[model samples]
Target: MFRYLASASAMALMTNGPVFAQEHDHDHEDVTLYRVFVGDHADAKVTAFDLTEPDRRWTFDTTGQSKLYAVDNGSAVVAVQSNDDAVHFFTSGISLHAHGDHADIEVTEPAAIDQSLTGPRPFHVIDHDGKVVINFDRGGYAEIIDGHELSHGELESTQLKQARAHHGYAAPIGDLWVTSVASDAPVEGDAAPSRVGLQAINADGAPAGDVATCTGIHGEAFSGAFLATGCDEGVLTVSDGSDGPIMKMLEYPDDLPTGESTGTLLGSKSMQVFLGNYGAKGLVVIDPVDEPHFRYVELPFRRVDFVLDAANARFGYVLTEDGSLHQLDLLNAEVTKSAKITEPYSMDGDWNDPRPRLAMAGDEIVMSDPNAGLVRRISSESLEEVGTVEVEGQPYNIAVAGGSGVDHGAEADEHEHEAHDHAHSHDHDSKIYQGYFDDAQIAERQLSDWAGDWQSVYPLLQDGVLDPVMEHKAENGDQSAEEYRAYYEIGYKTDIDRITIEGDAVTFYQAGKPLAAQYASDGFEVLTYAKGNRGVRFIFEKTGGDEAAPRFIQFSDHAIAPQDAGHYHLYWGDDRAALLEEVTNWPTYYPSSLDGAQIVKEMIAH
Candidate 1:
């Protein structure tokens, strides 16, 4: 049956496939299933297609067009959360491909959990082993979905929440389940720990004790035998327990200042986890087996996207907005080399724009470039582009499962939680409000200077002049000033016209103008500028200034470089951001011809 699908796909490729020939033959044992699950832009529904063969041979649909965002195929059932607060589950095991020349795109017809989660929005939908965990602030609970059963359809929903919404995780061991406590405290960037206690679901599948509480790990996962949790101070490593899992904090060296890391991926082959630090784009490999130590490897570009392959622990791939794939060597602990797979994705606008994400299927390092609407399959060993497959919609995530596709029946350990609504009542043109005071000095009021709460992205914080981390004070999203500030708003009219979101980059046209942001080879520099080290800063050259030799205006450092200067935007601290401001303010302190004071006087007199 599978052979027919392959032949039909191959035959169809003869007419539509690229004229290019194979650089190398894919042997049989190398066969791996790489499913590119794409989510719609405005619709919120999801579609899945296979990459090993072209033509996307099959497809899977979601319930009521939820923003079919992330997937956890690890549990055999793929779950999608709707932007409308519906948690939908689908048996990934279906005869999706059907028989080649003809396609079933057989959808096992996704079913909505009878219990609506307290969510119009949910952040993370994770499944560890067979236990599925969902955290929805709108639902006002952290519900644990039972994965042990085949019929994931409403198996069980356990809600855990106290106040509004925040992100949490489920730590699943054989019989014991560790869930985060609910908290109402304001969270900055999905980095804060829950205030709720950690609940232990005993072997009997009952909530054993009261909220088991602590400043829980920012993110949790089972690394080999130890269930690991990330914290601001250090990591809390949980180990096997006769009764349940035990937790311990693994601190970094005192000299390291205990940098916090998130977006952790547990190793499938080793007891290691890959964490990207908020301070910079680097991987801190925590070797849990050995006395824990964070082996850091910094990449030139911020590690925007990453994937783990414990089998090939030697290296991992990072897809940066700069449009390049960095091959970071775990052993040497650095980005050894890089290759360009796509055009540069603009750093100009919105954060959720279609970007590529890297995932590994066995030894193959494949990247799903949603912007290009294609998958760039590279040879994991050679780091060379082997082939590219296009899937419609935005291929945001990819999950590989052992089973091809099936409709498994259902089973036990039912846990249910109260549901909530995650829908926000803000209008589409809602203005974004950043906090008042740039540098605690003045105001930058937008159309909201008078209108107040009924706004969005108001009094914009200009990204070019000042990079500020505005306070976020919103949740369960009531467009209140407090809630609106929790999210920042920036505007950019992008004309990514014809720019293929192919490899790591994109080439597009905006208003008939060509634009690109490829990776810079010359390493960038990190400078600290402000007092609390909280001031935001970056290396930016004014666009429309000069393309030949771009001039750089780094606020963190007092130095000004004209176009033709060669430098990269690496890292910068508050010190760099401030000291540069002080130096630039010299016209009031002391003057120099370089200060442009003389030119200003001449212009005024003229």
Candidate 2:
């Protein structure tokens, strides 16, 4: 079967037809699956669709119009209906598991978990470590639920209560809960209690530290080791300390203009940077660890909305009132690219008015255009319009789940953790594999095992003529056809179109130009994946060859014994250690005897 590429661990069990096989029907393989969830602007409904089959949609009703949040590492989504005082959970039905060398994917139908949480004004939802916290602004308490239990359809929560009801926020930080504080007294006719500062509390609802001064604290985000809360005066940062949670006030720089403070913040998952709004036409990049902490960036126009690329941490996307989507470089603090996306969305209307929202779906950026009643997909690398998904009502908020992972058959068993230790420990050693497999039929082999001429299948995929094969894989596997194509597009790119393996000699052909080398056995490495399955990589080092030839090459074709390879993924580089670290790009090849149509038939039949 076709394979998918991405990252993560499996959270739930889902069984289906035969294990995803290419030639060997019993051997399991990886596949990519991405899900997009959109909440309607005026209707009490949410719509979901896989990136592969956008035409096939799934809909669910809520108590009221809601805002969606992708929590629990994309396994589930939390829909918070503040006005209705209700929260709902739905599993995206896409789970990814990381084997030491690759990831496995499982895709199921998206459905509600049949659970709900109701409180007075359920507002901000925060997910940290393995916990999800829903702060009820009027209830004056935050509900903390284990992310694991949540994916399993449970609604139990440990309430972290405050002194009184207020428009506040709370998040799980290490072993303590960092919660916003309310004032002692409330003015007459006020909607809620006034927020004064922030305080840390234990898991048992007891105080862990004194309240830190943060007048009118609101926005909060986690970046690296720090959790920042936005304040009128500045930004309050909290991190784990040797003794307890440490709080620090990062006041606005002296050079920054007055009357401007961050009220909305977005944090990076890979870097220690925080991107926050600094008034209507400017942005602030907060470096929580270094000096000269606040770096301000001027915008082209008033910003409508902005989102960070969690997968690729160096960039962000900002939608301005000009109906333009601008790519922001977090590392350089500048606008790197821009493209007009929709009709101008003025910021003059009510703050809650429907507008465009941005979300990252794999390598593409998905934006909700409420006015157009469509969800637009933009290429992150090119910032160009690629495609669009139409919706009946205005599409307002969107949250994406699903990634790439291998799907071991229903009968597959969990791999021993010692396999991971073995892979890591033998990084520098020439021989890594040491009888990790229990089957007598699977054993180490010689260089003569897979000696033959091979051709690459990348050109066929690039021409977009393999839809039938993709559709077949989609029918048997859980994901859509387009998803499988996208997966191969990334995993099968290569300059060398042909390869010939004979005895101890290997020849790589680039445009009919051959670079041949003699290789010696360098042992094999066994890797444990997210599911209880494992894969093996046969290693070889160049003994005599042209200088242009790579010093090392590893071949993985779902085989470990002395047998011929029907097809294989090849990783070649000069650095033996770094080549093992590379997982995203694996140039694949098949027998030269197979023609284009035959290859597609082979894939479909497999």
Candidate 3:
């Protein structure tokens, strides 16, 4: 079976399909999985695992203790080993491909890519658009690498330079790079110069616009269309404008006490809001559009770590020194839920000392407990400890990347064919449903609708017994006979040869062994295809099954209602939502009693 890898050539080939313009929201199955990467405080190693299956884990040895960043939308994780002056990339092996209406997901073994970035003190790693910029503090430049190329093991980068080295950051925005400017004065030893302001530079590293004053600018985040950076004066914001790059400062309200300023900012993906650290014991929710933008949330104790809920932007999570995990509501700027999860991790030690770090996995909050030597999972809604994964050393820095998406299985190549504008000709004629599917009378179906013994058609196609069927399709279809045969070779391939449905029980047979399960109707979904055709997936959830039996099974016949199924395509997986996302790898089956010639005749008749 061909596993989908996010390689350069594979990505290039994927772009050839037609973009899904519109999608109808309907009840569909989705498979959601997450991979979390954790950096040890004292060890030069990063551990990773699928949150649900922590027993099966992957580890990568780094040059020094590292800070992890989830980049390329979680397809890869960047390890910024500051003390070692080296940066490394690890493929999370979990990728989600969004197709306007739905997304396709592929999972493989996580491994270290060939590319590595080394310089003097690699500090900040920023991912924007589809590019990742790694800031080398003492090198006076940040290397901007394309996220796609990096996923494919490419090390090429464009350097965004400054006059002198400084503890600063730069982000790639459109055609220009917004970078921090350091003072021109010489520094002692490896110490960096103090930041003076921010400026936009062209691809050639020349100044693009006037430098905007941002004294002591340190932290930055992206909220909607705006990029906000922290400064002593206020929050420096930048956005792409018709004239050029628009840079402005949102000054802090005068009513705030002295020595109170936000240094770290977390932006919401679902809303245009920024959550920044206000002093030691307060969190500020900044609204860019409204006046009196700052909404301060007072905590019971000093903050240990905080993270924004990117999936559900309504809430944020904060861990205080009292070991309490508080859920912050962004809209109201209030602490909604709180629970003590770990032992008190005082804020009295060094900034880089072992402590809890926060990361989001779907709607759940994943926090690292260094003293406990464990990574804990807490429900965002209940604020309760749901699970934990043990680590050997102090789990310091952490990041998570994974989401719900459909797995198209081996039909990865078939999706590339969809990018074109060719009309897909089906063996069955469009007699019942025509034009827009909005008028189609779709409804839920019973297991009895497709009952009885069914045999996979893969062997017939492989043995050239289905050559006449391919020839018949080419005569009435858009593709050639050879092309249709090759496409079917992938689409109809399957290990399970026979499936028997009796009452609520279904049995799948491979070779001679049978795995039976009891199934219940889970509902159905009508999907609009890229070719303007629509099909229905009648879903079933396993009520009781053998250990190896799939948790979910869905059938796609040409029927949309209570008609008996003749031949159908079947999809089964543990993740119901993910199985619905799969648009390819449909293993088709016909009546087991039908001979090769009879099946060919039935195909031509359809």
Clashes of 3: 8
Candidate 1 segments exceeding 4 Å error: 1-32, 60-77, 94-120, 151-165, 173-175, 182-217, 254-260, 263-265, 271-274, 346-350, 402-606
Q: Return the TM-score for each candidate structure.
A: 0.51, 0.67, 0.66
- How much lDDT does each candidate structure score? 0.41, 0.74, 0.75
**TM match of model 2 to true structure:** 0.67
RMSD of each: 28.8, 10.7, 18.1
Q: How much does candidate 3 score in TM-score?
A: 0.66
lDDT of 1 at 391: 67
Regions of model 3 farther than 4 Å from truth: 1-29, 186-191, 415-606
Measured with C-alpha atoms, the lDDT of residue 244 in candidate 1 is 68
lDDT (10s digit) by residue, model 1, range 418-504: 111212121111000011113433222211111111101122222211122112111111123322222122111112212222222
Q: Which of 1 and 3 is ahead in lDDT?
A: 3
